[model samples]
Target chain A: MSLDNEQVQHIALLARLRLADDELGETVEKLSRIVDFVDQLAAAPTDDVVPMAHPLNAVQRLRPDAVTEPDDRDHLQQNAAAVSDGLYLVPKVIE
Target chain B: MKGQWEVVIGLEIHTQLATVSKIFSGAATAYGAAPNTQACLVDLGYPGTLPVLNREVVRMAAMFGLAVNATIAPRSVFARKNYFYPDLPKGYQISQYELPIVAGGELFIAGDDGAQKRIGITRAHLEEDAGKSIHEGFDRQSGIDLNRAGTPLLEIVSEPDLRSAREAVAYMRKIHSIVRYLGISDGNMQEGSFRCDANVSVRPRGQEKLGTRAELKNLNSFRFVERAINFEIERQIDVLEDGGEVVQETRLYDADRDETRSMRSKEEANDYRYFPDPDLLPVEIDAAWVEELRSALPELPDAKRERFVAQYELKPDDAEILTASRALADYYEAAVSAGSGAPQAVGNWVIGDLTGALNRDGLDIAESKVAAEQLAGLVDRIADNTISGKIAKEVFDAMWAGEGSADEIIAARGLKQITDTSAIEAIVDKVIAANPGQVAEYQAGKDKLIGFFVGQVMKETQGKANPGVVNQMLKAKLAG
Candidate 1:
């Protein structure tokens, strides 16, 4: 379950993060701890234990495939950092 | 140079519950809301903000369990699924582990070989949704939309009982239909309202041990899920045959490229350090609430399909398609009731012209321009010989454009059926007189010439003449 330096670097690149050289050593330690914890589950005797699907035996209730909500234009634009009329605005480069 | 192989496929589907509010908060579970507007501070996971479990979500999870014929636990716990994403404001998702709301149910999927195979329902649990991360929209940095952050979702995990892509898609469709029929999820794929992920692995035939499984994520459409799974299965098979091993990881489906690329290794449950959410209490439901929800459920898809076949005398194939959506089934029944004891005619109109119009206009059955009663009135006109089938089609087209009731449109456009015998007889007589050369030809033992006279009568009546009446009168005249 232990990960080497190269494997740690590869995982970081795959996850879309930038880590410092010092942080790499630290991440390796934390990640290994996490992996070791998950590995404990492999031995908890699942041979006779059926995986749980749902907690209850009731059928899932449904709603009419009806459109229940209206499009909220004002509410949609309320949190915009910038707004112009009905549209959202952001920084522009070329005119 | 060949070793035998067997493929083991399982599906993990995330179905959003049809609840009015988010799973843990009172924010309206509305899609397409303003970013972060639907989110409350609790959903943002602010310090000191406690999470409260929505009782309705638990009831929904329980109902889904019952529908799948799964077992229910008297007590279920929620745990935090730790993950880091911009859209996930909590930095972790509230999900189920160790104890889920429902467990050990199976869905019977129809196999291609005219038999059924039961896909084991490993677990069905209630969970809160993560916020949306919009990777597009004019920037390198992704925007975070939390409108869906607290929305309640029921994740149904299925065992790797599926053997083929077809079975996987069939299972998905059945689940989609069941949820829709139960009023659980809108099951809309376009808005990411109903989504699923697939786990695929391969093993040698007759082997009991499992293989390294790769999980495919963000499949928004049924077609993509099927294609992605099929492609992944084939890819794994190729890798194994070439002496390569399939690594366990999380894969992202690039729909544009139609391939699944490895994102990262799959995380185990403990990766999140799934501890019970301290803010929320464990969910508990009494028998009374369960019975109430059960009574409120409409006739599900399978029962409705059976009734359509038995009561309406529709073929199984036709009934399956018509009752696939509850809206269409309701529309069909309304039209039949309006037709007044003519179920077959009603079925034809709904399945044929009405559905065609709906598709052409890009509308769902519930959004059709023609009401069910209007369609009934139109069918009655045909039954009473007020209009021929050919003209009924024309009237249906007009009605679909919101031109009012069939009678109103017929009266306004003068498209009523020509049922008067004398009126039709006059056309027949005029045709007989005008076509003397052809009549002479008919009398010279051209007994098959009745169709010629019928055509003339139709032209004289401007295609409104009842073909039945016209043919009868023409036969008598030509015989003499």
Candidate 2:
């Protein structure tokens, strides 16, 4: 129901984000408060209720397996930081 | 290999669905395009882009479920497997987590000990593939090709029933055959259409507890699957033999070195915090629709192999080989029915020369230059004694070269069997008369000399002599 500084730091790490040492306390408190608010739902008696994938009672909409999207690489790559040979370049990943 | 240690292997095969577009987007899924041309806004992980399920992929997953005798889950949920990778633009792969599309299936594979062994399918879940990380030709950076992103993939996880690397490959091959038969996947490993990751562990012969497992990744080929599992098993056993504990980790199989190494340090390794994605709802498949897909599925490998053995009177091994692929089995059956060739002989032709030619020319059975009826024509010639078995190979070669039909080729090349008894007798007589010293040697109790005379007769007839009739006539004449 609550989170610790270390747990929040690990969560940040998994999300590929960094929480500064000075900002860690505030972030952990905010995350813990948010978790506690959501955790209240677990206190309710709902043993007979079916688990839901979404709050809405609707099923996923399916699309026909057809190619309708056009080449939007140029438009999309305008937002990227780097590009080469039509490939989006990033920092070296593999060791 | 299996020795004092018992190796248990399980495989997770990622089969790229043969859908025309990406699983969640309308972007094209064609491979090897102009890098990012096929990638769209949704595939590029732009904010506010949502994924919609592709109907064809759901149908394909159900078909595979039925083919493997698995249960198609009526309600399947998608989850986000959170990870950080440059190739995965979304930073989280949308995959099935708690509930999957297909579950509790079993596939029968040829066991390493030469028996049919049943391998359990734990589950098969639909997921999106990550883009390619082009590490080559980049200095201190990696290039990302988003064309592969959002492509549909069915991650089939198998239970650890395989006892050896051979069994693992056999199971992988069986799954490959099923997917290909269902037309759900092209199953092309070279182009990354099909990929496999194996979890291998070793145990003592009588040990009930399994050893620590190392999940081996990047095994894209069947041979690599077998070799990687074998190498990982040996590595584990070696660690145990030296009194060192086998560490649980993800390992990468180095195809160049033929060994597996730990992919990342345990400290920084991936811990995928999987949760239901809020953007997508549960996919509800109707039981009747599953039945409809079942009716549409082609005869699976096992059923086809059994039918081949019964209908064609073929040996089990031969039937197995002939029914390795639906196209191959269909070709064999078509060849058998379209003409008067015996089913067994036609099966042999399809499994032998046809397969040989397909392999030699790097052609799929569907791309075979020779049609089934054409091959059946050649088989019919052999069956009817119009051409000796030896000469049929020549006819087959000519047919492969687009020369013409068997009858046309035989007529044009004068390659027909010398079936007329008198004509064949004349050649046999000429051969005996021309080789008198060998004939004298044949009469002097050299029984093998009949082969010499038969060869001479075949040469005289230009290999057109019916081999069976030549043998009988040669035996009778050489008896004197």
Candidate 3:
């Protein structure tokens, strides 16, 4: 499960993180420790144990299958970082 | 060639739960909110913020388990899947791992033979969605929109039972309909409301061991999901044929190019460093709560389709299409209850004329101009001969145009059935007199001219003439 130095750098680049040159060696070490821990999970006795999908075993209870959640404009607008009256504010696209 | 290879295909479908509030907070789960506007302190990943599990989300996951006839664990744990992205303010996602909400269930989908194929459900766990990263701005940095950050999602994983791309789409659709039927998700792909991830690989025929699989990421549409899997399978087969191993990795489906490209190699569990979240308690669902949810469950699609067949004598295909959506089924039933006639007649009107008009206008059953009861009333008018079927079409057109009730439309337009035999006979006699040569030909043994007389009578009465009465009167005049 352990990744080499090159693999760690590749993962960080894919994730779009700007780690410093000094941080790469430490990151590689920390990630290696984490990988070793989950490798132990592979050895657990999963042969007899059915992989658990859900916590309960039974038929599902359902609603009337009608639309319940509706959008409320004024209230929804409360969370915006920028707004003008009722509309959201974004950087102008056109001159 | 290798000894034996088996393709293993599993799917993880992410469906947005139709809840009014976020899964972990009281913030509204409305889409299209301003960037960061919907983010409460907890959703924003502010310090010391703890997540409180939304009861509705847990119940929804349980309902999904019930629908698939799966095992629901009384106790499940939420683990933090750590990752870094600009949109993910929490830097880790709280999701179910070792113990998911539901397990060991089977979803029944339509196979190529049109028979039921039970696909094994690996797990369906509850999780919160990440925020959106808006890169449309002209800058090096993308803006983050946290409106969807804490929205509730049910991640349903399926065992690799699907053998082909067709089976993959069928499985996804079955899940979509169930979530929609349970009123859990809208299952709209265009809005990113429903999304899919597929794990695909290729194997030789009659193999046991699975091949190295590639995970295709976030295919929003059903077609994209199918195409992505098919393309990846081809890619893997070609790679193996070229003496290269099919590396285990996550791939992206480029819809624009209809191809899949490597995004990143598959991450081992250590990459995420999954750990049980400290702020959240182990989700312990009580039996009583499950029972309450079960009691509130509506008639599912299967049961409803069966009932439609048994009660209405509808064909299997007819029943399936009519009950595709709960709203459409409800509308069909309402029409049936409001009228007294054969179910087939009502079904024809509903599925044929009504559905056609609705589709033409890009409307669903719920958005139809005619209410269920109102439609039934119109059918009743037709069944009782208050209006001919031909005239009923006109009435229906008027109803579609926002004209009032069936009776009101009929009265306003004077489109009543013309069953007055005496009046029709007078018109028929007049037409027989006007066409002397044809009438004489009819009496001289060309009996087919009787149809010509009926047409003339119908024209005289402006199509209000009941064709049955016109036929009878025309026959009597020709015989005498």
Residues B120-171 of candidate 2 have per-residue lDDT tens digits of: 9999999999988889999999999989999999999999999888888888
- DockQ class, candidate 3: incorrect
Candidate 1 segments whose C-alpha is farther than 4 A from its true place:
A1-95, B1-8, B137-140, B201-213, B237-245, B264-270, B421-460, B469-480
CA lDDT of each candidate?
0.79, 0.89, 0.80
Query: Candidate 2's error at B238, in angstroms?
Result: 2.0
How well does candidate 3 score on lDDT at residue B414? Answer: 86
The sequence of per-residue lDDT tens digits that candidate 1 reaches over residues B67-172 is: 8778777667778877666567667899888889889988776775758788898999888888755545655345556678878999999988987788989888
Model 3 residue B379 CA deviation in Å: 1.4
- Once model 1 is optimally superposed onto the true structure by TM-score, how far is the C-alpha of residue B446 displaced, in angstroms? 11
Rank candidates, TM-score, best first. Answer: 2, 1, 3
DockQ value for model 3: 0.09
lDDT of 2 at B358: 89
Screening candidate 2 with a backbone cut-off below 3 angstroms (N, C-alpha, C), the clashing residue pairs are none
